[model samples]
Target: MTITQRKPLRPDDIIINEPGDQYSCDSCGCDLTHSVRIKCADPLCEPGDGVDICPPCFCAGREFRHHKRGHAYRVIEINSYPIFSEDWGADEELLLLKGIATQGFGNWKKIAEHIGTRSKEEVEKHYNEVYIDSQTWPIPKLDLQFSVDPAEFQARKRRRIQALNDTPPPPLKHGPVSLPGIHEIQGFFPGRLEFEHEIDNEAEDLVKDLEFGVCLEWDGDQIIEDEEDLDVRARAKWEEERRNPPPPAEKGRIPGKGPMINGINGYHPPSENGSVATRESLPPKSDDALANGTSSGDGDEEVEEVTQPPPIETKESLAFKLSLLEMYSQRVDKRLEGKEVMFDRGLLDYKKMQASDKKRSREDRDIVHRLRPFAKLQTAADYEVFAADVLYEALLRQRIQELQQYRRLGLATAADIDKYKSDLQKRTLTKANHRDYPTDKHPYRRQSSGPDPRRASLVSFGGDSEGRKSNEREATPRLPGSSTGQGPIVRKLPTPLNLANSPSLHLLSAAEQVLCAQLRILPKPYLVVKETLVREYARRGGKLRRREARELVKIDVNKTSRVWDFLVQQGFLNIASDVSSNHASSSQDASTASGSQVNGSPIKDPRPLSSQQNGPAPVPSTSSS
Candidate 1:
């Protein structure tokens, strides 16, 4: 080897130059000088930067793109070596350490990607040399002492163990005892069966035998006597017979027996002394008490007629309640009076019942004839409805009467009077107008009313034709949720009778009946007069004389005469005067005008005084005589 001076190449020159001056192109095999030759830019290549390339390799940006983009090249000049920093800076070293920590050692490809500078091989070599082979780590050693006296160590170990042993053991904790399930218990004890298998098998065999058993010989006598006795029906019959046996032959014919002595009384059947017979066991009629007698010789013996007294009436009595037939009769009477039947008729055949020549079959005709005598001739429902109607009509009439009285006294107006009549019609008459016609034009609007062309004389029910037309004009279609904008005016009727003095007042619903007893009476003398009338006569004891009653109510003698006269004229009190004597007044009857006598009917029209018929009149006040 001759001693020759060689110039060092720059990093850029080294990056493109081949190892030798003249080299074959790896791609074309052309011999290349340093100026024309370049190395492959891939750092991971086997001969990194040593492979020779020609200028053609740079065409179309092949080496300049992808992996080789931004790669450096060398510029040759006079002899000058490249200035390169081979040692890493502090930041680079830190990056290298962090990359190793994250990517781990020998993962050079990933470490290189992270560090962004070194090749994988370079990174591997650096990491292995710096961190593995040449590394000196500071590992702290624990300064310890294991050497000890045998006796002392043994004593300390024993002492520690003794302390642990000396600590009192925790009290034994008892939890709820969990019992095993049936199957679990059976499984645990394999020899034992869960149920009585033999008993079950026997039962199953018995049931099977019973299902397909031998036929039995019929023992009629045994069934009739022995087994039949065990039957519920037979036992019940036997018990019944034991409880109520037949009467003794000696005591059999007790004449004039039972409640049938009077046919009007509740008919009881004939039986033993203690037990009464059912209707089926009663004897047939002996042609005596029945209306049509068959025996001719028995005409000479006068048959005693049984008379029944009227039923006892009490405070709790419903006896005064009218039968449905009576209600129907009352309705017919009212209908004949040329007035609208003041009640709901429901589905009643009132027209058919009234018509004499109405078509009907023989049975229906017979039924109608038979029922004609009874007010309860129709169905129970018809009767119920009829009674209700009569009651309702009666109350309506009473209210009408009260209204008339009120009007007479100028306590109520004509409009107020009309309202009650309208309400009564609405309640009683089903044919009354219900639907309102639209004032506005509507497709389903009610037809406007006009006189029928066929009829020369127009007729209307209850209300007059002109009033009906007026009503029709006012009628307007009501829409859901729309306000009528007019509130109904309510008026109270004037009560005539004091409820406390009336005996049958309890029949009316308390909510409906106005207690005149509690009314706010005008004129202090009027109240005193009423009090005196009620106390002296209407109260339990007996009637009082006029003088005593006037004194009791604390009215003056002259005022008494005026008040008494007023009461009598108003039909509040009934007084019978004595024409025999001038000074002494006869026994006065304190009649509160509670109601009418027919069915304890509601009060009819109250006849007010002639003087007060047209307008309000001042209460008569007699001056001191």
Candidate 2:
């Protein structure tokens, strides 16, 4: 549609909500709660008491309850199946479809596994993509069948499970074990061991009620695919676990100390006392040695040594208060030992480490301070916990940024991410290095990835005058005379013409550039019109319109998004016309032929572009650009 005529089909084209709806608890018609509200009924459609649209109505408006089309169909087609079917139109097999839709599109076995279909064989089984979406362009055959040897086996009925799913449970390591020196501790601990072992039917149960992070596997290596060093670091974890196991207790029990449910002397209590002797073991033993020098086997309790300070009477001074706080910390560490503790202790330890390392702890403290403003907690202590989570995350982020900087500067090793991650994890977890430090990928990691549409306006303004100036630069090169071959040589630019004119235009995110590529305006020359399109969109409807067509210069026809669509014809493209040529048809064709314009003029539509159809790639048919 031309910029002026570019109206949304309806006031709200894509209604985010459903008509009348029950998202969950269908039996009671209870709304299925979600972190985010779903489009219950379409926002566009209204259902009512003849006019009052309910959530179910809006949710089921059109899209939500529709029999979903699997997105992989673009690459999974009947490579060359003979036309013989019941009533079904021939399309790609689901297996082929799913494979090409995912990452590693050409791996046959993986594809088969993905689609729950048969995988590759000795022969390469190629498939074509068959899109059910009439609006969506056909995705070309992305080769999805790699022959196997030292390769992943092509999926068969027997192997329905993917690598990420269906892992065997570890052996139940929940029994007692005699340990040297540990036996003394065990007497007090008196509990079941927590050796790393799996429960029976754990995987089987997950197979039925699978939620996220259901399975863990040892895929030739531990699956810490988030970064490198996981394999080496993973071993360090088990070594520590093996070396320092808590003394094993009886079955269905944990030992030594913890919350009330377990330990006899914990905060949350069975009255702060563990199991009572079952009418058998509690009485004092009849042996003489038992009553002698051996201490009661109730775990080691530290005896604090007392040193009296120089006489302080009545009102204890600030020095005394400081001493009290110091005493409190020592007491906590003595009692709490190895486990989760309060933020105050953790922060103090963090500061101690910073001072020891000669690094300013204030940077880490500042991070916590920044997070303090966003804290959901009401109390100061609770906010400190919140601050710790923030501080740890911030520190990790800083490390990751440093790693990324190293990568950019070409100083990065394959180990940079993992090494830096290890450093951050050590800082966060403190002495506990066995378990993982969380690795999170930010949706908007870099500051520069986002766009300012006003910049697009600035771009529009800057380009016209600058484009004229560039035109002047090109036409009047470093020439002494108009016709002389040698005054000063006119050098060819390494980059394209339009790029030199506006370098800022190219400084967009890859995703943004991909959006621009969908507009098929690589090395864009028409900034004025594009900026106009953006401004027109904004003026018409701020976000909705702009989002409809955001970054235009690098739109890739193949990708899908809120921005540019391939379903509706772009004003630039000249598709092979489906309509037959007749006098009336020809006239309309001529108008549509120039793409809502007349005689290929800049009259309006930007049609008959250089290469709209048959774009640069028969590239791996990506679901996204």
Candidate 3:
């Protein structure tokens, strides 16, 4: 029986009854025989509250809950039938159903919006409980057999391989592939398979001719059976054409000229009909000639070979001559330039060498001045001691050689005797050379007397003069008993003769003279002032410069003070002071003095300072000595 439809059926339509069924659902017209019924308990059947519904409408809560969304509906006991739990009534279930239809499964927020009173979580829970968890349909079982039987292995393997080979390769991905959604609702919809099949068929048709073909190998050197083979007659025909080339055409030949003239001479200007003759002389059109020589033709006149004259002997090309001249000039210029640079370099080197020599000389003089006192302490004895081992070894070897010669001969040979004598004399000279002069002794062993040798060397001109004089006198020969030789020669001590008044200072008692001389020689400031003053005094001729002396002693400018006062008090340095006052003390002492008069400007004390006060003296010696 067909039911007349006035409107499109929704999910509620499927739940409705056939046209003849009784005890039917009011919303869907379904019979309540097997379906559970939702009968309203309110006594308001004519007031629209007693309408009944089938199990689907009750479970899905279609029009039943749609109409009574604001009202409460209570369940009444009916004949027992399969029923959904009443805990989630028609409203909640219907909301879920409508929500799924409108918004699809996962979007529960909007689903909840359609499901007003229910939360998205409650709707999801109810749907999961009813449709997913309590689902009556079982999941299709996958009968996967991971282990194959050995007996069937060959058949199974062959089938698998054949399937793989027969399977078409996947279509080439042109760009990015759009994958179908795993949870897509469209898969559950009807007619989707038909749409998919239509799309695949159209795609196959478009790509059918675009498939890649099988690949094969080829070699160019091998001739294939499909190529034509030549016969002997064909080869003969080719040779005959080559051996007898066609005679020259009229246009190629000189017009109005015989064959003899054309053969001997090369080309001549064409006659008046050259254009017409050229067109006519072209080879006839034929299949064989077109295939053989269609591209060959004599359009140009024959060229005669001519012997060329040897190139004329002329002066070199202007460009080449100019280039050679420029090269030579550059060579000469470079030579001169290099010579000039070398000369300049040599001159610079010479100037540098001269300047370096001058600077080195100045440095040497300064070094000598600084180290003079220390150098004077090292006499020849120190050098001899340093080389003693070498000298001893040399002498020992010489003696041994002499002994050996004498033993071999049983007597000393003249050459060996002479060598031994010469060695002895040489040893004596070596010892003499090694001796310290003025008194042959080591500097460390000798006793010292006199001022510091540094001071003596700088200041005591008188001592050096006396030593020289004594040396001269000692060098003169004398008879054994001369009066001067009878006793130790009496030598007068070297005083500053330029500053002495008389030689009779020995007339007074030694003590008194010592006091007077001490008063004359050493000033009060001598120790502190010695180093600077000695340097300055040497700058002067053993006389102090008052201005330089003031600067030298100027430790304190505020005090007028001790500066140069010692030299002034001793009357040794002539400063701006009364000469008579400087001499008064000396004159008064001179009148009361016992014998010799003391000169006011006397030289320093002649007697050497005690040797025991400082270390030993260096024996006097020149570096050469």
Estimate candidate 2's alpha-carbon lDDT, on a 0 to 1 scale: 0.36
Models sorted by lDDT, best on top: 3, 1, 2
Who is ahead in lDDT, 2 or 3? 3
Model 2 ranges off by over 4 Å = 1-362, 365-574, 578-595, 598-625
Per-residue accuracy of model 3 over 10-55 as CA lDDT, tens digit each: 5532311121123677787866733457775544443654667665
* lDDT (CA) per prediction: 0.42, 0.36, 0.43
Candidate 2 backbone clash number = 52
Could you give me the TM-score of model 3 versus the true structure? 0.13
Cα lDDT of model 1 by residue, 1-625, tens digit:
1233455444443221112124565666776632455565455332543555567764544542233634554432211111111233333455667887888877777776565545567667765655566435222122323444545644554464456456553444343244443334323222342232321233333223222111122442244434333343444555676699866533333334435433433336445676656556665666564556443324644433433322323322322232333554555454433212211222123344446436645544555455433343545567556655655665688788997887785656778768767876865542222111112232222111122122211222222335345433333344466445432222332343455655445553442233223232333335546666766655633334445555676634434544444454444554322111211332333222111111111111234657435543321111111
Best-performing candidate as measured by TM-score: 2
TM-scores vs. true structure, each candidate: 0.10, 0.14, 0.13
Which residue ranges in model 3 land beyond 4 Å of their true spot?
1-625
Q: What is the lDDT of residue 150 in candidate 1?
A: 47
Off by over 4 Å in 1: 1-521, 540-542, 577-625
